[model samples]
Target: MIVKRITNVFFRYALRVITLLFAVSVIGFTLVSLSPVDPVQQYVLSVGSVSPEQRAELEDYWGLNDPPVERFENCLSAILHGDFGTSLLYRRPVIDVIREKFANTFALMLCAWVFSGVIGFILGCVMGANRDRAADKILKRICLLLCSVPTFWLGLLLLLLFSVWLGWFPIGFSSPIGVMNSDVTIWQQIHHLILPALTLSLLSFANVALHTRQKLIDVLESDYVLFAKARGESKRQIMKRHGYRNIIMPALTLQFASFAELFGGSVLAENVFSYPGLGSAVSAAGLNSDVPLLLGITLFSALFVFTGNMIANLLYGAIDPQIKESYANE
Candidate 1:
């Protein structure tokens, strides 16, 4: 029975992951295909010295003369083989360029996730325990106010306050713009990261705190909680031994899902801070009509979000046994 349940859960999400990937890929390909901008023309203009014959050859090399369906088929085949094609803009493989940029984005997102999650979950537990009191009311009001503000606006405000006004952080990427400083120390790297990470963390904190507090509040008032209290457990003991277990699964699911959504939408925060992450690269690709790089980033970002959702689903099922049974019928 345990094996059957596990198999069912795994199969359900496996199918979901496959379906989502297929849908994302098809949508990305279709949109890029329909764009009136010509990638070959963009490439020719950037390269600056090609005869008409060379231009025709370049188009033929990219399978531009082939039927649309055929071109898509070839692209699909290359993508399946882990070749995301070569970038005309950067003169490198799209996969290689994206890998470098994605690492930067991943590091930025990781720091933001950790900072927000730990602080938010702690505050949530406190607020849940002290419902309707001054602290809870103030925190709730603050969360609501922050949530009303746009992410980009908040990011810019933080940047101005910290970097421009106080001069606490450098205003841009790790090194100077377009210059790589291989000798940048660990401390310098962390210094460069602080403002942008904080900006993103602030944007993320409210959701996790709000959802966790609500879930914890419900758990605190349940029959088992009351029974535990009746059986001589202190409020602290009841919460530690019973309440948290019941609440954490849902709260955790919310956190992971939010983390996924935030990573995908963090372009604005990264861009506003002049952070040399994938966000800037993606923007450049769009403006230049760099098809390969643009498509690579799109697919990579979709995969990251999908993977996060997968982790949330799996973890929720693992911690809350009822989740599998509940989802089984669905």
Candidate 2:
């Protein structure tokens, strides 16, 4: 049975990845095609004044002069060979740019996700358990207020209050590279992360708290929960063994989806903070019409979201045996 479950999970995950790749390809191709300026023009414009012959030469060099189908085929071939092509603006390999900035973004995202998930789950569980109590009411009102504020506005407000007003941390970017171990303590590093991570976490926390509260409420009212209660199970035992177990599966699914949103949302937040991350990289590439960099970032982000969702689905089945049994029947 375990072997069968594992096989099923892998099969579903494989299908999800394939679907994700297809969707990403379609979206990337369509958006690029719809843009008014061609990469050749943008490339020439970036390189200063150029003669018509030079423009034609550049187009031919990059295969941009090819028919649309041929150009797409060439692009795909290059991508398959791990050649993201050169950035016209940066004059560097697209992969090099991504590699340089991806770590900061990933680290920021990791911290934000962990903080949001843990805090949101705890707050949500408490609110659900207490229902209409004062604490629940207060939490719900706070969540609603947070949700009402735009993430960009909230980030700016936090920056103003913490960095500008209080002088707590640096305004932008990751810690300087190549520091001796002694220059910055662990506490200092964490202090530097507080603003960006908090900005990102606020949005995620509101979302998770709302979803978790709703899911937990539903789970608490389910027939299984009622039966557990009727069996003279202690409230604590019922919550730990039954209520939490069931409520958490859906919450986990929502949280995974929220992580994907965090990546997308990071673009704006990163820009606001002047953070040197993938989001900022993509924004720069877009303004510069750097197709390779743009496509690479889009594909990378789509992969992250797809993989997260696939893992969530597998986890859902694992945590809930009925899900597996239903899948087996199907």
Candidate 3:
């Protein structure tokens, strides 16, 4: 029965992924096709005036003269074969360019996620446990204020206060002098990440705290919780074993959605900090009208969102036996 249930889950996940990939491919192709500027023309303009023969040759090389549907089909084929095509601006394979910058973005995202989830969860649990008290009210107000603040503005404020005024860390990308200095160790790398990570974490933390507080409040009000309380279960035991456990699935759902927002949000943060991440790379690609690079970044981001949601669904089953049983029945 467990094997059957797992197989069904895997099948559903695969179907969803395949459908999402197709949808993304269609949307990407459509958007690119509808753009007024021809990539070939843009390339020609960037390269200065070219002879008619040179223009034709460039178009032929890029297969730009091919029918739109044929071009899209070719693109899909290339993507399926793990060939992301070449970037017009960089003159390099899109996959290679993305791979080079992925680590920086991943590191920043991981730090932000950890800080947001851990801190936010703890604060939220405290507030929820306290319920209508002064501490709960204060925490709620703080989270609301944090949510209202713009991420970019907050990032700038942190940059000015910490990096500029205090002289605590380098202001920008992996040290303007490069990462090779003997003084620049792993701890130094983490120190530099502090501002950007904090800036990114603020919004995520607020979201998690708000969601967790709401979910915990709802869970605490449930009949099972009340019954446990009546049975003389200690508050700590009830919260730890029942309340927190039940809230985990909902929290995981919100976290998955946050992953999508983080990619776009990180772009602004990366710009402010001059971080050498995929967000910065995407921004550069957009400015340069590097279609392949832009597509690569977009597709990569889509993949992240898709995979995160899948993991969240699986986690629901693991954390909530009721959810697993319901799925098994289906």
Candidate 4:
């Protein structure tokens, strides 16, 4: 029975993912198809001058002369086989370009997630533990204000203060320009990472702190929690064993969502700092009407979101037996 239940759960999520991907692919392809910019023509224009014969050859090679439906089908088939097609802009395989850039983006995102989730989680726990106090209220209000601030503006502000004005960290990209010396240690690498990571983390901190505070308040105020308090349990003990445990799943959900958001949100920060991440590549692709690269990036983002949720849900089930039992019952 347990095996059947797990299988059912897996099947359900699998079907949903397949359907979601299919729909996203169709919508993405349809939008690209409807656009006035022609990849073949764009390529020809970029080459300065191309004869009619060459233009026809390029169109045929890209399947540009094929019907929209046929082209889409071919794209889908190629994707299923791990071929994202040649990037019209870079004249390279989309997979190769994406793979190289993904490492940088992944590193940036991982750093951002740690900065946001760890710092925000700790700050939120303090706020929640001190709920209704002046300090808690003040922090909450401050977070609310920060939440309203635009992300791009915050990134630029960080760049101005830290990079331009203070001259502390390097202004752009993950690495140095020419060569690595004694000054270019891992510590130096982190120095470059800090500004962009912090810029995004500040915004994530607002949301994390708010979500955490609410979850902790609910957990702390629960009847069981009150009973423990009345039984002369220490605040730390009660919080460690009960309050924190209850809040962990919800907090995990929040962090997972933020993890996905970190990737999507990094686009602005990357472009601002000239970070060689997926977001920067994506923005350039869109501007140049590089449909293949744009589509590839979109698919990567979508997959990341789905993967994050899947991992979160799995952890949720492990943390909460009730959720597992509910799934089994279903």
Task: Give the number of the best model, judged by TM-score.
Answer: 3
lDDT of candidate 4 over 219-325, digit per residue (tens): 99899999998999999999998988888789888898776668767898889889888989999888888888989988888888888888888888877889877
> What root-mean-square deviation over C-alphas does model 2 reach?
2.7
Q: How many backbone clashes does candidate 4 have?
A: 0
Question: What is candidate 2's lDDT per residue for 4-46, written digit by digit as tens?
Answer: 9678778877887877776787779778988874788777776
Q: What ranges in model 2 sit over 4 Å off?
A: 1-12, 176-188, 325-330
Candidate 1 residue-wise lDDT, 1-330, digit = tens: 667877876798789877877788788888988988689889889779899999999999989999888988888889889899887778999989988887878788888898888888888888888899999999988887876778888888887888899998888785544545786777887888887888788888887888888988999889999899899999889989997888788777777888565774468778887787888788878888999888888888877887777888788766777876676655
lDDT of 2: 0.83
Candidate 4: stretches off by over 4 Å: 1-10, 51-57, 180-185, 326-330
Per-residue lDDT tens digits of candidate 3, residues 252-302? 788877888788789999999998889999998877777888888888889
- What is the TM-score of candidate 2? 0.90
What would you estimate as the lDDT of candidate 4?
0.86
Candidate 1: segments with Cα more than 4 A from true spot: 1-16, 49-57, 176-180, 323-330
Q: By descending TM-score, how would the candidates be arranged?
A: 3, 4, 2, 1
What is each predicted model's overall lDDT from 0 to 1?
0.82, 0.83, 0.85, 0.86
TM-score of each: 0.89, 0.90, 0.92, 0.91
Per-residue lDDT, model 2, residue 256, is: 82
